[model samples]
Target: MERELALEFARVTEAAALASARWVGKGDKEGADDAAVTAMRVMFDTVSVDGTVVIGEGEMDEAPMLYIGERVGIGVPPEVDIAVDPLEGTNLVAKGLNGAIAVLAASPRGSLLHAPDMYMDKIAVGAECRGRVHLEAPVKENLRQVAKALDKLISEVTVVILDRPRHQQLIEEVRQAGARIKLITDGDVSPGVAAAYQDSGVDILMGIGGAPEGVITAAALKCLGGDFQARLWPEDDTEIARCHEMGITNVNKIFTMDELAKSDDVIFVATGITDSFLLKGVRYFKRRAVTQTLVMRSTSGTIRHIEAHHDLDKKPLFKDHRIKLLGE
Candidate 1:
């Protein structure tokens, strides 16, 4: 992909963030998600590529837009695989909490895994520690290796995990290992990406999250020269069949960074809708809303932090339609 294409990905997430911020503290998750999806779809129309949604909200029957198999972009440049989470943390946005974001990653056609909407057992680390931490390894052993790789005390290392019931035992083990633990309410994708950034203060990420999110996070890690490993956790026979249908025959198979993204030329972009470890939430003033975004490209290993300001009093993109419908 051209260098300019990375900016387009940023624009998509920026639009989603701007739209979703309006629903903050409104306690409406579906409405927040809908606004983000609408804005994302509209922004994609202004891009210059034939983008296919490989990992998205749901299958075509369920979601109105940004659904799996849905096509985005303006259909001019190279065809690419698109993976998106219009609103990564709906609950966070509803509660006016942290870790909510609008995220996307794209690559050459067929480079990304068509991750099914299931649970994935994931482990991620920075590039220097790649091939050292294994999902099957004992928790203490992995922590020891990571601490050694970073030349830090085990007590000084911190692991980021989603606060879910299934992770209770994992949390206990990390605590027992004497490593610090950071439990997040939602949006494991951001934490996973943070594990790769040295200044992010996240040493590792381990837990089960949405499979599509695991792939998206892996894409970001790949761009950051980090390492991630995951295995699909099919909940039942139906989910197992779904995995098989997606050409995943070995349900217990483990996937590495290369296996997850399958390419080096990838782009990942995320705009924060709420405060999180990596990015801050949008802040609104009397007349403007401010947004922060992170955009990264694997080819150049460049990560850009973008801050934008938009006027709130300006007419929205759909104002003309609403006016015409009301015969104003």
Candidate 2:
């Protein structure tokens, strides 16, 4: 993959962030997601790459735009596989909460996994503990290992997990291990990204989230030289059958970061829709909207934080009186 594709991919997420930021706190999660998908799909037309959606909203029968199996971008060289979450945390954006972002990843064709839309049990940590954290290990044991890797006491290590009823036992075990927990309402990608960076106030991420998200997180962590381990959690026989159809014979087998993202020739991009410790939320002021984005390319080991200022007047998506209504 060309290194320049990182910036081009960032443009796609930035457009989605700019559109979705207007729907923040609107109490309409679907509306916010719709705006983001529409804007993102529109912007993909401008990029020059032959991209296929390996992971996206849903399959063609389920989602109208940016669906799985959909071909994106103009027909060009450098065929790429894409994984996208137009709005990572729809609930966060709806309630005006934190940690919502627009995220996507692209790699050479046949690199990213076409993960099914099902739950996956994952354990991700920064590069310091790249090969230390294990999915099959007990929660407390994994915590102790990560703490040791970071040179921190068990009491000082902080773990991030999604706030879900399915994680009740997992949460209890972590608390018993004496590590602090940061439970987020939605979003699995940001926390994984945070865990990959030492200064992000997150040391490790655990518990279950969307399997497709695991692939996206793997791509990001792959760039950070971190590790992600995942196992398919089939809720029912139907899900198990789906796994087999995808040629995944062993649903219980754990997948390493290399297996999830395949190679280091990958690019990850995210634009914050709400403020968080990792990236700033979109800020709109005087017909001008500012956005903070994180872009990474594993090939060059290059990571960039881009803050873009857009003149809303020039954006056809928000023209004349439309910008004022969004600000209101």
Candidate 3:
């Protein structure tokens, strides 16, 4: 993959965040998602890559999504596998809550795992804990390993998990293991990636999250020189059959970071739609909306935080909406 494409991905996610931020606090989840998807699709055309959507929206429910197998980009190459979550936390955006983001991951063809959209049991940590945490390991044991690796006491290591009923037992074990917990609702991508950054105050991340998001997380961790592990948690026959259709015969097999994002040149980019410890959300100025994005490259092991100022008038359709109060 070309290193140049890394910045191109930032534009793609920035467009999505910029478009969706308009609906913040409107309490319209689907509407916000639609806005984001539309913006992302438009930006993909400008990036020169022959891309295939291995992981996209619409797999969680019947709602419209950037379906799997969808082709994006201008038909150019380094033929790539593309995965996107235009609006990672629709509910968060709809409620004007923090943790909403627009994320995209791209890798050379056959480099990214075509994970079916379903639940995936995941465990992630920074480079310090790499080769220590395992998905099959007991929850407390993983936390212990991370705490030891980070040179923190059992009570000091902080683990982040999605705030859901499904994670009750996992949370309990973490608590019993004496590690702190950060329970989040809706978005896992930020926290998952944040776990790999020591400054992020997130030492570990584990739980069942969307498999598609898992692949995206793996890409980011790969670039950050972190460790991530996951096992497909297919809920039923439908999801299992879907996995088989993708030629995944071992649904229970654990996937390491290298397997999930196989390419040495994977690119991961994400623009925060709402505030979080990892990245700041989009901020609207007079005539432009400023977006903060995180871009990473696995080949070079570089991570960048970009702040872009957009010119609303140049946007395709939201010119009026974005610059309405600017009086242009």
Candidate 4:
């Protein structure tokens, strides 16, 4: 993949975030998601790659666009596989809460795992702790490993987990292990990637999250030189069958960073739709909208933070959608 495509992906997520930010606090998650999906779909056409959606909105029958196997870009060179979450935390955006982002991961064809939409039990840590923790390890044991790798006391380690009933036991185990906890209501991708950045104040991320998100998170971690491990957690026969359809015969197999995002030639980009530990939410100004985005490439091992200001009247991005500005 060319380095120039990194900026193209930034524009894609930025458009999605700007479009969906208008729906914040409206109490309409579906509306916010639609705005994001439509904007992202439109932006992809402006890029110059022959892209296939391996992990996307949904199946062809479920989503109108950006669905699995859907083709994007200008039908050009650098064939790639795309995995996207146009609105990663629709509920967070609808409630005007934090931790919402529009994110995407792109890599060469056959470089990304075709993860089905289901639950995946994940454990992630920074580069320093890579090869130290394992998904099959007990929660306390993993925490202990992270603490030892980071040279922190057990009580100094901070683990982030999704706030859900399913995490009750996981949460308790972490507590018993004597690590601090940060619980989020929605969106685990941010924290999952944040674990790779020591300054992000997130030591590790644990618990189950969407499999599609796990792949996206894996791409970012691979770029950041972080360690991530996960196992598909299918809820029933239906989901298990879905995994098999994707050629995942070993349902209990643990996926490492390399397997999840096969190649180092991967690009991950995300734009914040709401304030969180990793990024700030979009801000509307007089005739301008400000967005903060993170663009990373595993090939170059570079992470770029982009802060773009869009001119409402001049930018072609907003013109195509003709979306009503939030403050206007």
Which ranges in model 4 have alpha carbons more than 4 Å from their true place?
58-65, 320-328
Q: Whole-model lDDT, candidate 1?
A: 0.87
The sequence of per-residue lDDT tens digits that candidate 2 reaches over residues 246-322 is 88989998999999999779999999999975799999899799999999999888999999999988987566332
Q: Judge candidate 1 at residue 187 and give its lDDT.
A: 87
- TM-score between candidate 2 and the true structure: 0.96
Q: Write the per-residue lDDT of candidate 4 for residues 212-294, one digit (tens) a residue.
A: 89999999999999999999999999989988999999999999999999987999999999988799999989979899999
The lDDT for every candidate, in the order shown, is 0.87, 0.89, 0.87, 0.90
TM-score of each: 0.94, 0.96, 0.95, 0.96
Question: In candidate 3, how many Å is residue 49 off?
Answer: 1.0
> Model 1: what TM-score?
0.94
TM-score computed on alpha carbons, candidate 4: 0.96
Q: lDDT by residue for model 1 over 118-229, one digit each (tens)?
A: 8999999988788789999999999999999999999999999989999999999999999999988888999999998888889999999889899999999998888899
Largest lDDT belongs to which candidate? 4
List where candidate 2 sits over 4 angstroms from the true fold: 58-65, 320-328
Model 1: ten consecutive residues of lowest lDDT: 319-328
Better candidate number, 1 or 2, judged by lDDT = 2
What clash count goes with each model? 0, 0, 1, 0
lDDT of 2: 0.89
